[model samples]
Target chain A: MATNIAKIACAVAFAAGVAAPVTAAAKSSTVTAIEERGTLLCSGHNGSYFGFVEVNDKNEWKGLDIDMCRALTTAILGDPDKAQIVPLSWAQRFPALQSGDVDVIIKATGWTMGRDTEVGLQFSLPYFFGGTQFMAHGDLGITEAKELDGGTICVEAGTTIERLAGNYLKTLGIEHTMVSYEKASELRAAYLANRCDAFAAWGPFLAVLRATELEKPDAHIILSDQLSNEPIAAAMRQGDEEFVDMVNWMIAALLIAEEEGVTSANVEEMASNPPNPKIARLLGVDPGMGERLGIRDTWAKEMIAATGNFGEIYDRNLGEGSPYKLERGLNNLWSHGGVLYAPILD
Target chain B: MDAAALKLRRSRRDMLVQTLLVVFVVLVIWVAISTAHTNLTELNMTSGFGFLERATGWSYSFSLIDRSIDDSYSKTLLIGFLNTLFLGLICIVLSTILGFAIGTARDARQLGLNSLATVYIQIFRNLPLILQLVFWYAVLIHMPGPRQAFTMGEVAFLSNRGLMLPGFNVSPTVVLAMFAAVVLLAVVIFRQKSLQPVQKLLLWLVSGSGAMLLLAWIFAPADSSIFSIPAQQGLRFRGGIGVPIELVAMILAITLYGSAYIAEVVRGGLNEVPSGLTEAGKALGLSSRAIWFHVKVPMALRTIMPPLGNQWIFIMKATTLGVAIGFSDLFYIVSTSITQSGQTLELMGLLMLSFLLINYSLAQLVNFMNARLALKGH
Candidate 1:
């Protein structure tokens, strides 16, 4: 008789435990919770993704994605080191965001119509533009993707590149088989071991892989054909327009800083001695932008001082300052031949 | 113990407790549904199985059934499910046979065989399954390409692309003859109650050999060939069974890895069988083979059944790791679909249902075996 009463009590307790979280989540905003926690939880790649997200020799996270997380955290909390990156597989990233396990996803996530409309997440503006391409051993003498006909291509599974490469090969009338791996490192290992004739991935990512991870960079070359556009962006949980606006404006601030010739080293000097009205407003010398976004006036200035302008961040992680040595082709400012442009900092 | 006494002793506390338990369960379920509804509504997404009818624009390299890129998502999932079942069933059969062999070898008196079995168990058992899978896959991938593949006298080929083996396209006559032979064998076996054991055996062998000869006679291309060997055509092998290297690697890793644990179980079962039973069999004037078949095996099997069934279940679960090596098992396909469609919750539900069905069937089968083998009184 007593055991029956105990069972009833246990059931009631379990029910209460299950129902408590819903009420708690309903009461507080996710942004406020992140702010209170002080650390900006970010989802990124588990395996080294070359210039995007990887562990350095010192075991510290160092990459373009990590810098983006730092920039977002600095804009929000006025501190860059408060950013914490949680590495996740490509399949786990969206689920992790939806479950609120991470505050934002600074992984090199591509923005797509299906993803935006179907998945319960919103993407910020495109921070980087890349396209699907192929890389093969230089000894193969294959200059283009069409040359990989009737050959196997190695790709990463559960990624856009897999679909892109598959579709592209179909269009090229090639009867090819794809062996996709779950992890980036495994894909590279299989390709390097000559298991696959070509490796399909984004152009910049392939460049990073070749320049940084390969035994000999000159031994392989990425094909110049751009099969599909991949506008990479940061993702955040939906239903928080404020948080979305905050992240979007943070990315825009970097582009605007590049336009205004603001570097991490020169941000403080530029803020103190404004060369133009737009620069004055951008550095928060004259407030209004951050107030509208429900953040502090010094948000852009803090972000710039921490991670530098878009050009500087690109150069440091994926361009001349890094081993990838990628030029700012399509990623350059709009005034140049490239298409990267920021809205006027009114 | 009487029903009247039980009814008279029913307390109000028991009734209240039962009520509370039901209420709690209902409340928990209610909360879960409402929360999911709220989240889906906020996301502006519809929840249902309507997406199953949509065409899967992607193509899979390997499928157990005939499928194309234009197939529906439901068909894709079914193919993935079948592939997973195929791998699981193959691994289970292979591992069981290998485990029994190794287990018997371990129990044997010879030091060389025993040491070899022990070394195999130790090595496979120590390494992680995923790491082993990746390693095997890497080895296969690094093998020579199609032009320089290792071949078996033009009958079979092994390359980094895959292994190709001679496949059969049985003629109508061969199929009819095989069916007729099976019926004939059944009839002969049924009528064998009046015949001597040697006569029965002779009848079986003649029928089997006749069936084989009939099939062999139909092998030539009078109308169409019964068997055809694979031949290289351009960059691909044509007219043969092409097994992907991914599948080979997955199966090899799962079988070899699962056999290690199953071997240990077999060894433990063998050790648990008392020597006194064998002594008793011998005292009863039973031969050594009779003692082993009657006493040792039955005794060992009674102990081995539960753990062996558990190992089988473990193997099925391990087939999910096939995703690492690009074998399009159910989990891998569902995960890829979720990534493409962004229907995590719905696809996860489907995945859970698939695994649950498989596990439930295995559990039922195991329970039935256990009941059949159970001691009479127990």
Candidate 2:
């Protein structure tokens, strides 16, 4: 009789232990949980991915994606410093967000239909645009990707580029082998060691590597043909419409700030004195914006002040203000001959 | 004093305890699975094995079987399993042979051989397997590329790309038949102790050639050649067997690392053999070589089987480290599958089941071998 009682007690305890987390997760909205926890969790890259996500000499996370994470934290909790960065690999980011280990993935993740539909994740607007391309050793004398037939190409595993490269090469009837590494550093090392004839990755990252990593940048050539043009975005869990809307508008506010010439330096002054109703509404000079989004009206103001507008972030990270010196290309605003256009602020 | 009654009471209690324990386990599993299902439903993610039929748009550096980007996830995973099994089997055979040689060298009279074996064991055993894998990979990739390959008389070529060797262009069925014939013939000859040496030789020669001719007549196509030599193509060797550097490095690292532990096991087993047995063989007018093999090795078998089985299983598990160097073993393929399909629970479950099945088979084989080697009526 005693043993039966003990067994019942153990079974009940085990059931409760398994069921506790599910109930806790279902109880609160992501925003409410962040508010209660007093910290916003955001995903960072596992290693240095130059210009996008990287660590600095001061042991602080500093990159475009890092700034984006901080901006989201500021918008949600009203304090950018409350953002905690959880470094994760490319394959780990989606599961991490789904499991609530991180609130958002701002690690320059590509938006794909399969991921959005099947992976239980939602993506914000395209914050950046890049394409997949191959870079080969100059000694190979390969100028176009088509010339890479019968060559071994290296790629980072668990990335969209791996699929794109594979399909591209196969469609062209090129008989090539592909090797994938788990880490970007390892892939780069393999390429440098000549383990593969070419390396396929994001075009901008290849450019960054050629500029910064190689002893002789001219020793490698980035192929002219591209495998894919991908839209990079911030990803969050699929549920919580309010949280997703907040993130979407937060990005719009940045683009709108850039278009209105409202720098981080002048955001405070502009918020105080309204130049126009649109700017006023965006900076929370008007009252209803934050209330509708379930956040403070001054959320955009705090975020812009913390991380600057979209143009400023891009310039500081990948454009003329940084070592990369990448041209704005399609990332520039629509009025400035680029494709980026923000939804009108009513 | 009612001992049988006490025994009956104890047995009844044992039955009750076991029944209660099983109930508790089932309840725990039900709770855990239901919780996962509820959470998955809440997250709006599908959970099932239906995703295995989807096409995988990825490719790996090497596979024993022909594969393409359009292959199904199941086929790709099977290829991955085959690659792991191939690497594991080769490493097991090579490490056992090398370990036995080194283990015997430790007991050699020559100081140089003994010291060299000791140093080899220490260095490889002390370092982590992962570091050794990376180190060997680095060494392999640093070799000359295909353009400047080290050629061996137009039959084999060694480059950073891999080792390419002459291959037989015969049907697989013919090869399998030939191998089966040889093994069967050897087993038959071993069982027939009454046969003389010349008779055994004649039987082997006649049967081997006869089986080869019969298999070729039945299975070989009209256009097939016996041998295909590797030759330089545009970027790599063509028309031959190509071994990728990742595979070579994996084999090299695992063999060296695994041999160290296995050599120690061998040495321990040999040490456990009583010196009296060796003396008795010597007194019986046996040569030293015969005595060592016939007396020491047989006696050592009982002590060696268990630890050696453990080493084999460890070597099999170590094949997963192939992922670190892009070898596309089962673990790597399943990880890629999870990333692509997002069926983590189902895919990880499959991966665990695969490893369990493979390692369990290896353990069973070892246990069988141990049973055969056990002294009878002990």
Question: Interface RMSD for every prediction, one decimal?
Answer: 2.2, 0.7
> Which parts of model 2 are misplaced by more than 4 Å?
A1-129, A231-346, B171-182, B189-224
Estimate the TM-score of every prediction: 0.62, 0.69
lDDT by residue (tens digit), candidate 1, A166-199: 8888788877777777788877877887777789
Chain A superposition TM-score, candidate 2: 0.72
Off by over 4 Å in 1: A1-130, A138-141, A216-221, A230-346, B1-8, B11-20, B59-61, B169-226, B233-235, B283-290, B375-378
The digit string of per-residue lDDT tens for model 2 on A219-335 reads: 888886667777888898886766777788888989999999888999999998979998899888988678877778888898899889999999988877876665676678989
Chain B alone: TM-score in each candidate?
0.85, 0.92
> Per-residue lDDT tens digits of candidate 1, residues B40-80?
99999888788889876665556776665567889999998
Q: DockQ of each model against the real complex?
A: 0.29, 0.55
